[model samples]
Target: YKAFEPQEARRILDKLEIHYTPKHGSWLNMAEIELSILSRQCLDRRIPNQEVLKNEVAAWQDKRNSISKPMEWQFTNQDARVKLKKLYPTIQQ
Candidate 1:
């Protein structure tokens, strides 16, 4: 394996910059969620060829676009408390 010389490494490092994202802020999560939905809704079946897969995905995309279902997050903290009450253990103080 070839290793970069010290001067070459310094030169490369000088041209690079690094940035950090804010905590708990990532659009990647939304992308993953959409892909998971796509897998469940459209990719659950086997496709004989690439052409059929492309057509199926395109049709699914068109149908999804036509619906234009707006995402609504009406589930509040209170709703979570009630729905997940069983998941939380009761501790007597």
Candidate 2:
């Protein structure tokens, strides 16, 4: 598909006022880890169809929810400011 023109993209972004994290950032890394775990633990076998896939995922979710534990996210904004400082724009004092 053709990409959006720069002006159009900028206009949309301005309208949405969306906040986005950088690629390979901690949030994205955590999401990738979750998806990898789901794929390995719940979707290791071939799913014959979308219906089967949906049912399988639902069952997996039910089982997971029953035994779910809170995730401990260690990364903090302060940590990001220190470790990923290069990715952020400089602040003027």
Candidate 3:
């Protein structure tokens, strides 16, 4: 797949005929990123026993999920295109 533009990326995906529902809509990208961070922070340490690990993880999960809030998204494709205009190619076709 090639992407000369964002539309080209969509076109190549359509050509492949891969049907997918974007989980969490556009938040899928950020959710994946946050999961990576959570995995590293919460699960990266080695515990001596499963019970201890579970208890510790439960505490961490409760603390995190209780206060966690969804991110505030502001930019759209058009907004990004305007602010980051220099990063994109001028030609679409």
Candidate 4:
């Protein structure tokens, strides 16, 4: 189960004895990420009612899924070594 509010979420977590970390930081939460993506792809500069929002989001999701691929995460230590040598700590060469 999940909750949107911190107090309710804490209550549920305590009852379930489960521990989870929110992405980003303590104050920077997942809702911000979701809202940013939704705004850019579906809601930016437009106030579609609930039904239209749902339908448009669904259509956009369908189209995106048809061509979507997994993201490539390539910012490994080696990339950082070359790109940010000054900031990165020395590694075995």
TM-scores vs. true structure, each candidate: 0.48, 0.50, 0.44, 0.43
Candidate 4 TM-score, true structure as reference: 0.43
Q: Runs in model 3 with CA error above 4 Å?
A: 1-27, 79-93
Candidate 1: tens digits of C-alpha lDDT, residues 6-92: 889888889999865435435565557668988999999888999999999999889878998754456666787789999767789
lDDT of 4 by residue, 42-68 (tens): 777675588987888888778767876
Better of 2 and 4 by TM-score: 2
User: In model 2, how many backbone clashes occur?
Assistant: 0
Local lDDT at 23 for model 3: 50
Question: Which consecutive 10 residues in model 1 have the weakest lDDT in total?
Answer: 21-30
lDDT tens readout by residue for model 2, 19-38: 66655457777668778979
- Runs of candidate 1 with Cα error greater than 4 angstroms are 1-26, 74-93
Q: Which clashing pairs does model 3 show?
A: none
Q: After the best TM-score superposition of candidate 1, give how far the Cα of residue 24 lies from its true spot, in angstroms.
A: 11
Select the stronger candidate by TM-score from 3 and 4: 3
- Per-model clash counts, in order, read 0, 0, 0, 0
Q: Whole-model Cα lDDT per candidate?
A: 0.78, 0.81, 0.76, 0.67
After superposition, which runs of candidate 2 have C-alpha atoms over 4 Å from their true positions?
1-33, 87-93
